[model samples]
Target chain A: MTIEHSILGVIASRPCTGYDIKTEFEHEGAGMVWGVSFGSVYPKLKSMEEQGLIQNYRTETKGRMKKMYELTPKGWEALHKWLGELPSYPSIKDELLLKLSMWDRGRPEDRQTLIYHMKNRKEQSQELLDYYLQWPQNGHSSISEFGMLGIQYVQERLETELRWIEKAILQLEGEPQPPVQDPYDLIPKQQERRNLAINPPVITVHPESSTDEDRV
Target chain B: MTIEHSILGVIASRPCTGYDIKTEFEHEGAGMVWGVSFGSVYPKLKSMEEQGLIQNYRTETKGRMKKMYELTPKGWEALHKWLGELPSYPSIKDELLLKLSMWDRGRPEDRQTLIYHMKNRKEQSQELLDYYLQWPQNGHSSISEFGMLGIQYVQERLETELRWIEKAILQLEGEPQPPVQDPYDLIPKQQERRNLAINPPVITVHPESSTDEDRV
Candidate 1:
């Protein structure tokens, strides 16, 4: 539904062919916030046109007939309504965190696998942060100051996440204790595997030792 | 697909009813990472059962029969495969950032609404952080040390976001300039709002205006 509103917003700004809207989403500043794949965009445009929120006309360019879409008054009203509403908190489906929750159940080799993936994530974050820092000056002349600020917000988030991952690696290696201390010392300490954060540690602990804990 | 894998992982740990799986998602540590609504869970369970990844048995309870599900060996193999694969970075669809991107297009009243919402978000973050801090000790005795680590990770993220939003509010109010400096002084200055941050009163004359050049 938000995607529909976003498409309406784009159409309200300017009448364009569906291809133009796709390109705008893929290449324009809007892409930075929400991405609409061509797979979803065409169907959305067709449905919206059928719903009377948008209207289309054919234009001939270089002897090619292209269907251009624009927002009707209804579309304008909808876009305005959406723009005025308070946004909901984004729902996150973080798989890494899910894996982390089950880390204790995994074998030592599985923990090594997890650490390897965390390193990959860290590298990706570094690359994204570097790219964002060097952006706006790199041919993105049309990105407004506000858009740049939004990008900076994302960069800051990435940096924070990278720091958290670094700490998570340390936790996985058993170097840093859990961030919150257990006052009762109920958490049983396991035999530490040799620094998996730096190198693949050997599995010395018996697998049966892990099964002693009751499953949630 | 990730949800299916998550369900598999949960079943692999223990044979339980679909209701148990739903509860594990809603009330357990996994809830902090990924959420699976009851609506999606039952269907996924049925599909996975058809795929032979999981099998279910009926157990007579005090008065009624309860369906319990457990992972097949095939399901165990699939879980291991998923655990080994490099996890993809979580995709965020932050509507607040989207709205911020178009901040200039909004009316003054809309800007106020946005600011109000940011404050609300800050309050929510603070509350969540406080809750995370007090968790595990608050009758969450079954939470493993690894689970506590995940909670701490989420807490740190929320704190970082709160800080970012504070800075964002200041930025939106036109008190602080963009984090990056303008190299060529090409950015046009708007009327300074108020000195929300310290070290103010440096209202230098515009370079082009001082040079008696044409203002675009």
Candidate 2:
């Protein structure tokens, strides 16, 4: 979704400046999930204002002036509708998995690099989850609740990924042990061999010596 | 990356027509990770040929003609550079987390939706990973290796996420018992209050008298 919708969602609750929205990301732990940048937020907010979804007003605070934003009636309606239609779950477009699909053709070193990156991410995710639990944020439980939830989500995913990395590392080392069944299992069955011969049958005897019965 | 690059990487391993590339994604296991469509592959092949990354030739076979493609030296170089460059790891941009981040101001129902969404995603991810691992590949260890690596990565992440979902569900239910704490520990120290008074302390007389005069 566009940053506009995200910022509007924030503004829908209460009026805020672009800086306020940026600060809100850190304050509310949005950085942990959405990863919005001020660069994208401000421009999108301006465009939203232009589109009449939000309205801006100048306000003086401690001898400084700032443009604070508020959702317009239209914006409120739009945000409400958006919220109503919001998908129940998160949609992920993971580029790493996409790259892994081509791993067979990729250089072994590249696969190693991907594994290395995931390892670091996994550790970071685990640490963050631990840190969240250690903090014991009671006063801001309202906010921390979500942060805790996200940290939990991320940490679990990371740990799962670390296992995959270890497995990948093992696989890259060499071909895994093959099953120790009879090697003949790898060969085709007799009926299939007979069918293959019949399709393009080669005569052991010369064609001139072959009788009609042999040909048949 | 673009589908063209993905196609290029696949073709660089061996000459293949657009149909072959499509088949690679469809019939082969490539679709599990690297997805490409026939409509896209044909256009990209045309573009690559025009750019000299590949060359096409036609051959007659049993009164029929077949078009074949082979990578040019330039294509190999391009693929080489792509392989050498840094690979981007997967990014999870979950919008539900965005909503959950706002749970502080959101209605309880919204938070409930977010929780349920995460739980569903956890289940779905696990299912997909399990399905990917069901096949028993014997000879192509590389494919099996990378395939399992990708699947396990996602599977472990799902388990991690499931834990988070459980945590969130508990929090939404109540204060989560503030985790467990041993009563044997000494009472925690009180935090010092910050001084934010607008005016300095007043030099007022004591209720009974002046403090200095009383001491004298």
Best-fitting candidate, measured by lDDT? 1
- Candidate 2 matches the true fold with a TM-score of 0.62
What residue pairs clash in candidate 2, if any at all?
Answer: A156-B160, A157-B157, A160-B156, A160-B157
Model 1 reproduces a share of the real contacts of 0.30
| Per-residue lDDT of candidate 1, residues A1-216 (tens digit) | 678866775664456888887777654543245567889999999999899888899999999999998666566556556667778766666777777665544433445677788899889878777777777666533344566667877777788888888987876776434424444443332212112222333464877755535343
Per residue, candidate 2 scores C-alpha lDDT tens digits across A19-99 of 888876653452244456789888888788899888889999998998988766576556545544444444344545645
Best by DockQ: 1
Residue B116 lDDT, candidate 1, scale 0-100: 78
lDDT of 1 by residue, B1-216 (tens): 788988976775567888888887764542255567789999999999999888899998898899998666577667767777887766566677776655443332345677877887788768767877777668634455566667867887787888888877886777533424344332332112111111234454776544424423
Alpha carbon lDDT of each predicted model: 0.66, 0.56
Using TM-score, give the best candidate's number.
1
Q: Which regions of candidate 2 are displaced past 4 Å?
A: A12-14, A19-40, A61-64, A86-99, A108-147, A170-216, B12-43, B57-70, B104-106, B109-123, B135-144, B166-216
Cα error, residue A85 of model 2, in Å, equals 2.9
Docking class of 1: incorrect
- Candidate 1 error regions (>4 Å): A12-15, A23-34, A57-66, A139-141, A173-216, B29-34, B60-64, B106-109, B141-149, B173-216
